[model samples]
Target chain A: MNDSAIDQKPQTNSIISGAQLLIHLLEEQGVTHVAGIPGGANLPMYDALTSSSIKHVLARHEQGAGFIAQGMARVSGEAHVCFASSGPGATNLVTAVADAKMDSIPLIAITGQVSQTMIGTDAFQEIDTFGLMLPITKHNWLVRSAEELLEVIPHAFEVALSGRPGPVSIDIPKDVQNELINFRPKSIDSTDVKAPCSALDENDIREMLAIIKNAHKPILMIGGGIIYSDACDDLKVFAETLDIPAVQTFMGLGVLSNEHPLSLGMLGMHGAPFTNLVLEECDLVVGLGVRFDDRATGKVSDFCPRAKFVHVDIDRSEIDKVISSMYSIHADVGDVLRAANNSLQHVTRPLWRQRIEKLKESHPLRLDGDDDLFRPYGAIKTIASMVDDSANITTDVGQHQMWVAQAYPFTRPRQWISSGGLGTMGFGLPTAIGMALAQPDITTLCFSGDGSFMMNIQELATLAEENLNVKVIILNNNHLGLVRQQQTLFYKKNLSAVKFQQGVDFAMAAKSMGVNGMNLGQVDNPHKQLTKALREPGPWVIDIPISETEMVFPMVAPGGSNRDMIHGEEQ
Target chain B: MSNENQSLLKLIVNNHPGVLSHICGLFARRSYNLEGVMIRPIAGSSSHKSCVWLLVNEVEKLPQLIRQTEKLIDVITVEQHDMKESIFEKTEQFFI
Candidate 1:
């Protein structure tokens, strides 16, 4: 990509319609496929796609199309594209677009709008596309003319995939798509469309290094931003070199390998009792790319109460948002980690490692040693052993998501995809399909809950027909497990609308839709059964029954301190 | 204003088509409510650039919100002012 925005227009403009120009720009961006649909306003663009090499995968719903784009972005770490028509089509794509926004997925969402003349006339298939999309996109445009497309199209991709990437929308009017104009393939002013984080002040790094040298008991907190900035390698070298105990936030799971001596798994409300206890005792915390979110820090004031912080984040806003810090570095995690490592010397902390080992042994994450008929925890552990560490694991929201995070062993970044920020249910199947489609060399496993699966279960058709090598594991608990646990814990165990009294035969449903399905119930050999099903060709849905009474433990009560957690012993 | 009234955020952004929506979307995702908005092209400019003033209800996260606004790619400068000082009061007289 050029350094700045493409500013110079073509020396000589060639006549072309906006629809044709849009196609040419897509070709320029090296787009292989798009999740989209055709409608009245967007038909011209759809027609253009027919002749173009960019394959369009027709989605059953606009939301599904949006999610497909999200899934692709998550796997490829590149800007993906999705399209929908005006009015209801654009409305349908809203959830997916919003999801992309919260998770920082890079996507270009194009919607067809009514012709410019009919924009405000209350004509058929007309709505305020630009206004509706304003609050849901990273940036959006109402393309008034074909001439504007020359600048807007390239700029849209640059904005979507640049620093702190997110979804951008372009609401193209039908008239703009249909209008013919002299297409200028000239250099447009390409300004840097990203505000890069300021570099860490050298003095700040030295001071942080001093803090590291001084503290006897310190921990490294890994967050999702590290993964986004590709600082995993740098973080590993730094943490391992200094022998610091490292704990990952939900999004930071693979910054350090699960088996590493420094790795302390995930920390937060649903964190291990031992991990939380370690946080309570630490003297200093070096948080890299993590926001110290409420879920991660139970009560804001009580998190690492005595610990001084050396916070590093690309976004300056996240630096002091939750916990006040002794020092804050408003720079990209990679740059800061690289610079900090140079200033520090290798020093081992045997005493700190001993303390962590004791903590880990005292409050182990799982009690079960093997997979059984009912424990999702054991099942995850078994799956961890069966699949390679590099396999892509995508999860839906709820108990299963936590189970995978806690039980499975992740060794690298970009292998774990979940709706962390928005916690959107029904993200599993379609996301898995999209991710697997993007990278066919590896198998993708979608861990889903019954409640979450039903939210967008129609995507099962997409999974079945596409023949993507995805393994769908349904931890069927017959209830909204996490929500039920929350109500039980806080609201006097009143089981409200959380139960699914009449559960559908998920295996049968999946089988009918052209994929292999197996319902392993009350099985004595669950590991063997699961492994056999996963080995089958194409996509397969494996439904494993779980107990409704089972609840994830070590949960810190809302607004309560990290130490104020409710463990299994308390229950 | 007791830190609860609508505050005007003036942003000087590169005249990119996507700048305005990006600012709005960031606030929306955070569930931050906006009161009003106005966008105008800067005069005497060959560069395609514009100024946007958004009136959003002040909350506890005002500082964080302003910092995020500054991070948007096209946004060059961000200024915050009391709603009482907003030109909306002056402009409303002409329209209403």
Candidate 2:
């Protein structure tokens, strides 16, 4: 289509309501959909959505709405919107909002505040939403006037997406949402958001380069910050040029194409066996955008005991917050990559490359090289192949999260989103809800461990109500797989709180929520069931009943090197 | 370990409201735990930013803790200067 074919200019000079202005601003920012539940306090806003072009999904609950927005934001790399009424509705959205804030997903939560007259009077369904959401949000505002709603609505989106990216909120009084005010939409500038100072210190950069050049074994640990900064290409190039072994955190998945030789899968508690081993043995660790979370480096004192760190991050506070640094570069990963590309000479290290190859062979993630019945690897491979390169995938924390990280072949950045630092359970369902809301056109897959899936199982009702086409894969081992594996290794098979006498009937649960569900993993013809689920129109769940005895291998024991892996039960 | 003049302190205080604000404010605002402070919520806590344990040495800097604790409305109590006890009962793991 030609530029002239579309309406390029702002249409009218007519007076409009504040609700309409809010809608117009949201449309101007290319936002077409919202995940929310309407109530008396903001009935006018819902009524306005009917007149405006934006589509709104009525969530079963406010928490579900917030999480759906989170999924949307993570997938689209843009801010997502969610709304709730006063009191209980607003309070219910807290956990989801806090999830977005913790994982640094860009989300906008607009709550309908009580009437301005009800302020401090403690009327029915009245709560100070702005005050309640303070700790969980990056920036929050109380729109006192209808005129302020126009400015604040768009501004909230800007703050939520800019810089580090987090959830922001705006509380609109019920009266303001209903009032007809002369709407004037003006673009706001937020360029002054405190960003990491540009350009790494010259000495620091040079020192880091020298260390990389000198080290016999060097590994690059990438984190969520890298994806947030959109510096995947630079990270990939740096790793390739130096032939460094690279291990990513859970958030750092998809930073490098899974096919890349330098990509050594994930590291930490549930990380690949070789990844942890290499990290331990490496003489130098070039930290890029990763916040050395405790999960990745168990006992910090003994973590990478031999490695000297060249910690590079945009946040100055994170530099020495965890591991002490041999050289610290506080700048955007993109800037550092450009600087490194210009300064460094290509030097091949055959020995270093060989070591990486050995590590891969030693602790390869093989679900079943021959045991076709246990199809963890095959299932992951199939899922990875089936989804679009750009499709977004969120995972619940557990064995499934780790398996996906190790086996799923991601070819682009930001395709995989998870609760990395927090290892939060119940993250998958909400994030998937958000993804489907954000990218309604693209298919989203949320892989959840049976235990983790149960934590936020209630969100299924929200998905059904909203009619979101989100596909969920429940890896049902009927046990806390990771914990079970840990106990088997360390506690001499004393499995406690690991087994469930009767597995949850997810199919029935989905039906209760008015959604489609099936147990596909145990079916002789699972392909047909899985294909049907993928093609279904609304939110769907496929419970894959995997073997409970199955253990995700290449495990690194506490207080041991990654090389010292307890591979299988017999081993 | 005593030769290093470093003590790894673990204090389980009340998961009171504004407890984090006070503890962090005391450390960050007053530059008390400036060397480094890693505070994460202990697994089972209903309160917000509650049940946070701090890993710091210089437990002898007690008077500072008491004064800061008094200023914070959320802090239920202050338990500092427990060196030998922490070594015996290592409830938490310290990572860098």
Candidate 2 regions exceeding 4 Å error are A1-17, A187-192, A199-204, A366-375, A382-391, A458-469, A480-503, A511-514, A521-524, A531-540, A554-566, B1-96
Question: What is candidate 1's TM-score against the reference?
Answer: 0.90
What pairs collide in candidate 2? A68-A433, A68-A434, A71-A434, A71-A435, A72-A434, A72-A435, A322-B96, A323-B96
Write one digit per residue (lDDT tens) for candidate 2, span A251-270: 88888887787788888766
DockQ, Cα level, model 2: 0.04
Fnat per predicted structure, each in turn: 0.68, 0.00
State residue A470's C-alpha deviation in candidate 1, in Å: 0.6
Model 1 alpha-carbon miss at residue A358, Å: 1.9
Off by over 4 Å in 1: A1-14, A368-370, A522-529, A569-571, B1-10, B14-43, B48-62, B79-96
